[model samples]
Target: MSRVTPTTSRSIGQHTHDYAYYRTVLANHALPAAFIDLDHFAMNLERLRQRAGNLPIRLVTKSVRSVEMIRRILAAGSFMQGLLCYSAGEAAWLASQGFDDIVVAYPSVEPTDIRAVATQLRYGRAITLMVDSIEQVMKISRIAQAEDVVIPLAIDLDMSSAFPFIHFGVHRSPIHDETTALILARKIAEQPGVALQGLMGYEGQIAGLMDDVPGEPVKSAVIRHLKKKSIVEVNARRQAVVDALRKDGHTLRFVNGGGTGSFESTRQDRSVTELAAGSGLYAPTLFDHYRAFKVLPAAGFALPVTRVPKAGVVTCSGGGYIASGPMGKNRLPLPWLPAGCRLLANEAAGEVQTPVQHALSTSPATGDPILFRHAKAGELCERFNELLLIQDGQIIDTVRTYRGEGKSFF
Candidate 1:
């Protein structure tokens, strides 16, 4: 694996000190507000490109949840090629905004969404749908035929490893072997209105799992071993599948793989044409444990201290913004900034109030702002309508999230 050099000049300690800066900028604004630091966001974008080397990046829209932010990343340059939308309806919505070269990363069973995508295809938009079964292919084929347009399709391959007693990845895509992939490709090729366009395989165990977690050294070591072996196996399987499809006379336009955590390793694979990433842009708390690269904390929210529960504890209003994943303490929002503050064990991150205990020399006063980082990136947008854009200690812009635009496609 190639070594990744740290790019940011500021350390975690420096970032904590910037709490004063955030307070100063948002002094006149309301509490329980979310913001993005453009300087850190730009730094992270550059680092993602560097890790990708020469390969193109497909921005994952689900991790951003903002059309304006997506447009900004695409306008950055040619390094970003297209979007990997999570929902078929969202893909059509982005298409209506004049963005092309989109691929729905998940399968859709909704007839209305299928018709919407077909309409975009008829209007000369480059949108591809994902399928792992022939049933989904036939559904899309019927819609394409009815609309009198040829829709593009991509195959989703399962890249997880099955050990004797352990399954080491996400449960997605039943098509694993090369034979299964070739059979599906042939089936799509025989269809009248749909054509094979791409292949997508996501190795979530290697890409999403953290290898440098703090407490469990033995568990972290085991996870690292599993990731190393999974990488080699997945690459070989992906290559074989691609070769089989080509031998069967199917020409695939693109092969997408990887995520924010696996960019360095995934880019080295010869079979993958493009890599998908987006969570790294926000640098949430869950992404901080990776050893390959260090990302800045670009996104966070501030809540107001409403009361002093005790000498060492301060209660803030409205914090319980937990992240989506397997249940654990890691999914809770982290009490960042003001350096040494911590969440109380008895009542950690409540819906109406959160009590924080600290050992700093100065105690938190009523009406003071306390900053925190969410466990995941775009999920923060679900709680707030808009994100205040901060740059160099000033609010430059306020942009709407998907929720703010009255759009929610789950």
Candidate 2:
């Protein structure tokens, strides 16, 4: 694990004042509540739009688990074209909500879920399924045939770099070469009740990897070099794949690529018709290390101090909401507001009680609120039922999370 130093500095007094504001506004609320600063969230959204330029952005639903929040983003502007859902169930639910142009970004193997999507397709809803294997296509085709509808499909291309003993990106999508993509296109063309609609290649190496890690200058340089090489190599390969598919008479509706971290680089590829972004809207802790762009911390949760375990140590009520990824300190939630407070290295964050050590000068009494930023975006919503929407130091509205709405697709 590489050490990450804060790229931007904030004064301790500033954090103190920010926490004071939150405490004052949510004085009546319960502990362990999540909040989103609408002002900061809007700023982050504008940053994403600027980085995307003229290219369309597909909102990633997994990064934002709230339907209300997704609606707010789509209503914000026409730049957001569609949704990249994480599951077939989520896509069907979104379609039922009158959301058109949804693409299930992951392959669905379950016959029930495929039948659900096929039902939506029979109703003339624009929902596309993602596939990287012939087995997946066969499954979808069987469901489509059963439902008596033509299902749309998108080929998920593996954009990871292949070295002698090193793989640079995530292990997703078995289709890596243009020949494989063309073969899949031909397969789809010949298969009954299925049509190729798009091509998706997520360059997670350039999009998710941090290139400006602190205390590891050599590692950072290597990451930057790899990213530069990946940009050129991925662009050439992706273009070739699109070209081959086009020559095979497959008219792709969209070529999706990029993420929040690699927005600028991914959009530069002429083959990618649009980019996908969602985590940037909330600007979680994992997005902090990107050097190309900086986003404001928009979403956070506040836990009430329940005990003064020892001098200079305050224990919060509940805070064991860790983000998903390789186990590391970076995956732990960060103590943000009331700065100078640090998580105890020995215990870290706990499920019931999280003991935080503060500077000797700042003494926080019991019942005071402690603000924290989750390592990821939508994962924070999973911990709380509702997110208290805040703007200008006041709670405006409360929206239900996916869990609160009685829907847990994962």
| Best candidate (score: lDDT) | 1
Kindly list the per-residue Cα lDDT of model 2 for residues 1-410, writing each as its tens digit: 11111122221111213778888988999887998887777777877887898998999999899988888888878888999999998899888888899999999988878888877777779999999989989988988887899999999999998765778889998899899998888899889989999999999999888888788799989889888988888888999999898887889999999999999988778889999999998888888877798778888999999999899999998899999999999999989878898899999999998999998787888998988999999999888789888876888889999988988887
lDDT of 1 by residue, 126-170 (tens): 999999999999999998898899989999999998877989999
RMSD to truth, every model: 3.8, 5.2
- Residue-pair clashes per candidate: 0, 0
lDDT of 1 at 11: 27
List candidate 2 stretches off by more than 4 Å. Answer: 1-17
Q: Which 10 consecutive positions of candidate 2 have the poorest summed lDDT? A: 1-10
What are the runs in model 1 whose C-alpha is more than 4 Å off?
A: 1-17
